[model samples]
Target chain A: MQISTEELPGGVTRVRLDGRMDIAGAQSVDLKMNIVAGSAHRLLIDLEKVEFLGSMGLRSIVIPARAVHSRGGKVVLFAPTPMVESVLKTSGIDALLPVHHSLDAAIAALE
Target chain B: MLGLLAASMPEALSAWPDPRLTLTSQLEDLALVLPWLQALADRYALTASTRFAIQLCLEEALSNIVRHGYRGRANQSITVECAPSPAGELVFTIEDHAPPFDPLAPSAADAAPTPQSIDELQPGGQGIRLMRRFSSRIAWEPTPSGNRLTLAFPLAR
Candidate 1:
C-alpha cells in the first residue's frame, strides 16, 4: 500500500491511497495516517486505486476518523472501488465516515 | 485472426488450478494466505461481491483462531481448502488445531437489540457477524484435535 498526501489551499489535505487495504497494507499505513488525521483540520482519502478492503482496512479508516472527529476535524473517503464500497457499506463504516464518488462532493462534504 | 490465436493458445493458460493453503496459527501467517486466496478468486472468476465475502470470512475465521483460540500458542496448524463444488457453489473449509470454538453458536449478546447510535456500537464480535452474513451455508464439526469450519458461498449472478 502507498499513501501520499497533498495540502489543498485550505487546511484540507488530500490523501491518496493505492493498492489493497488488506492486513499487511493496513499495517503499513495506519500509524502514518493516524498521525496525519490527528493534525489536519479536514482530510480526504482517495480510495480510487484500492483493490481490496478487509476488516483491518476498516479499522485503519475508523481509528483515524475517530481521532479526527474527536479533535473537531473531518475525514471523508472518495472514489472507493465497487468492492471496497460494498465492504464499507456492509461493515457500517459509512455511517461514521461518509464516502463520495467525486472530489467535489468529498470536499463539499468536509465543508 | 482472433479465433486462430485463441485456438493456438495453450490450455494451461485457460485452466484454473485449485488453490489450497496451510499456515500456522500466527497473526503474521495471515499475510501468506492472501495471495493464494486471490489466486482462487481469480481462478474461479469470482465477482466483486463474492471475493469480498470470501476474504472477509477467511480473515475473520483465521484471525479468531490466532487471536483467541490459540492464545499465544505457536506451531498450531491451520489448513484451508477452497474449491468449486460439483453443485456449482464455492466451498471453503478451514481446519485448525486449536480448542473447539463454534462461531455459529449465538452468544448472549446476539439476542440483544441493535445499537441505535454509533457510540453504542460494541467493541468486538463484528467479524463473526460479517462471516455469517456473507457465507451462504456454514457448518462446524469438532475434530479429534480441534475444530473444522465449512463455509459455502454462492456465485454472483
Candidate 2:
C-alpha cells in the first residue's frame, strides 16, 4: 500500500491511498495515518485506487478518523470503488466516516 | 511466515480443484494467502462482491487462528483450501491444529460491535462480523485433531 499526502487550500489535507488495504497494507499505513491525522485540521482520504479493503483496513481509517475527531477535526472519504465502498457500508464505517463521490462535495463536507 | 504446502483436498471436498495452502500459526502468513485467494478468484471469475467476501472471510478466519486459537503457541499449523463447488459456490475449508475452538460460537467476545458512538467503536473486533456478514453459509466442526471451518459463498448472489 502507498499513501501520498497533499495539502489543499483552507487547511484540508488529502491523503490518496493506492493498492489493497488488507492486513499488510493496513499495517504499512497505520502509524503514518495517525501522524497525518495529528497534523491536519480536516482530512480527506481518496480511495479511488484502493482495490480491496478488509476489516483491518477499516480500522486503519477509523483509528485516524477518531484521532482527528477527538481534536475537533473532521475526516471524509471519496472515490472508493464499488467493492471498497460495499465493505465500508457492511461494516458501518460509512456512518462513522462519511463517503462522497465528488471531490468538490467531499471538500465542502470536510470544510 | 506462511508456507504454501501442496496438499490434496479431503474426501468430502475433493470435487474442488487445487488451490490449497498450509500456513503456520503466524499473522504475517496472511499476506501470502491473499494472492492465493486472488488467483482462485480470477480462475473462477468471481464477481467483485464475491471476491471481496472471500478475501475478508479468509483474513478474518486466519487472523482468528493466529491471534486467539493459537495464542502464545509456536510452530502450530493451519491448512486452507479454496475452490468452487460443482454447484458454482465458492468454497473455503480451513483446518487448524490449535486447541478445539469454534470461532463461530456465539460466546466469542471478539465479535464486532455495532458502534453507537465513536467511543464504542473498536478497530480489531470486526473480523468475525465481516466473516459472518459476507459469506452465504458457514459451518464449524471440532474434531479430535482440531477444528474445521467450511464457508460457502453463492456465485449468483
Candidate 3:
C-alpha cells in the first residue's frame, strides 16, 4: 500500500491510502498509520483507492483508530469502494470509525 | 519459505476435478492466493461481487489457518481447491495439517455483541465472521490429518 498525507484546513490530517489493504498492504502502512494516529488529533483516512480489505487490514485500521481515540482524537473513513465498505460494515468497523462518502461530511466529522 | 505446491486430486477430491494450490503455512504465501483466485474468476466469468466475496472468504480462512492453526509456523502444508458445484455454486475447500479445529463453531466471539465503541472492540476474531457473512455456505469437518473448511458462493448468472 502507498500512504500519503496532506494537511487540510482546521488542523485535520488527510491520510490517503492507495492499494489493496490485504495482509501485505496492511503491514506496509501499519507503522506510518500509528505515527499519524499519535500526532494528529483529527484524522481522515481516505480509502477511495483501496480495492481490497481483509481482516488483517481491518486490524491495521482498528489499532490506529483506537490509539487516536485514547488520545482524545477523532478518526473517520472516507470513500471506500462498495466491496470494501461491505467488509467494514460486516466487521462493524463502520459503526466505530464512522464511514462518510462525502468529502465535506468526512472532514466535518473530524472537526 | 518453500515454493507453493501444485497438487493433484486426492482420492477424497476425485469427484471434483478442480485446480489445487498448496502453500507453506506462512503469511507471505498469502500474496499468491489473490492471483490464483483472480485466474479462477476470469476463467469462470464470476461476477465482480462474487469474486470479491470469494477473495474475502479465502483471505480470512487461509490466514486463520496460517496464524491460529499453524501458529505462524513455516513450511507446514495448506491446500486450497476451487471448483464449481453442480448446484451452480462456486466451492472452495481449504485443508490444513495444523490441527483439528472447526472454524465455523460458535464461540464467545460469535456470541459477543457488536462493540458500541472502539474501546469495547476486540482486537481479533472478526475473520470467521467475515467468512460467514460473505460466503453462501460454510462447513467444517475433521480430517484424519487435520481439518477441512468448505466455503461456497452462488454463481451469479
Candidate 4:
C-alpha cells in the first residue's frame, strides 16, 4: 500500500492509495494517515489503484475518517472498486463516510 | 513480489529476510501477514490450487494459532515459515508455545467449524476440513515444548 498526498484547490488534500489495500497496507498507510486527524480539516481518500481490499482494509478507513470527523471535518472516499464498495456497504461504512463515484465528485463533496 | 524480489531480497519464502515476517503469534499480525503472503504467492504466479487452498488454509491455521495456540497471550510470539520444494510444493511451518494439544487428534466437537444451527448443516469445522482440502498432506508433530503443524500445497500454475 502507498499513500501520496496531493493538494487540490479549496483546501482539499487527496490521500491516494496505489496498491492492494490489504492488511500490511492498512496498518502502514492507515495508521500514518490517521495522525493527520488534528492537522487537516478536509480530506479525500482515493482508492482507484487498490487491487483488492479485505475486511482489515475496510476497518482502516474508519480511523482517519473518524478522527477528522470528530473535528467536524469530512472524509470522502473516491472511486472505490465494486468489491471494495461492497465491503463498505455491507459494513455500513459507506454511509458512515461520504463516498463519491469520481475524483471530481469527491472534490465537489469536499467543497 | 516480482518487482520486490531480487538477489538482495531473496525470493525464497523460507529465506525471506525481514524479521517481522517471521513472527505471527497474534491474529493482528496474521491480518498484517496474509496480504503479503497472497501478494507474494500471486507475484510468484502460484496456481489456483495453491492460491485458494493456501489462502484459506493459512487463514484457518492462523486463526487456530491465535485462538488456541497462543491462547491470546497477546505478549506471546509465534513463528511462521514458508518455503517451496523444487516440484513447486509449498510447505508452511507454524510453531507456537501453546499447550501441547494436537488439532488432528480427534478434533473435539466444540473445535469443529463454526456450526450454523441445531438442525441445518453449518459451514463449520472448516479449519480441519479446509486444511485437508487444500493440502495434499497435513501433519501434527507433537513436542514437549509445543505443537508443530506442517501444511503443504502444490504451487499454482
Candidate number of the best lDDT: 3
Candidate 1 lands at a TM-score of 0.85
Candidate ranking (DockQ, best to worst): 3, 2, 1, 4
Listed in order, the DockQ scores are 0.33, 0.69, 0.76, 0.04
Q: Which window of 10 residues has the lowest lDDT sum in candidate 2 chain B? A: B1-10
CA-lDDT, candidates in order: 0.80, 0.84, 0.88, 0.67
Docking class of 3: medium
TM-score of 3: 0.91
Q: What TM value does model 4 have? A: 0.51
- Misplaced by over 4 Å in model 4 are B1-24, B27-71, B74-157
Residue by residue across B44-155, what tens digits does model 4's lDDT show?
6786445655665666677677777777778676777777778777788877778876777765424544323222222234356546655777888876788788888876
Candidate 3, chain A: TM-score against the reference: 0.98
Error of 1 at A19 (Å): 0.8
lDDT (tens digit, per residue) of candidate 3 on A40-111: 899999999999899888888889899989999999999999999999998888999989999999989987
Proportion of true inter-chain contacts also present in candidate 2: 0.57
CAPRI accuracy category, model 2: medium
lDDT of 1 by residue, B1-157 (tens): 8778778996645766556688997889998777787777887778878877888788878988888889969888899998778777899999988888887777722632343444543334566666777889888999999999998898655
Per-residue alpha-carbon lDDT of model 2 for B1-157, expressed as tens digits? 1122224434344343457898898888888887787667766778878888888888888888888889947679999987668877878999998889877778773566678766566887777777877889888999788999999998764
Least accurate stretch of 10 residues (summed lDDT) in model 3 chain B? Answer: B1-10
Model 2 DockQ reads 0.69
lDDT of 1 at A68: 74
The numbered model that scores best in TM-score is: 3
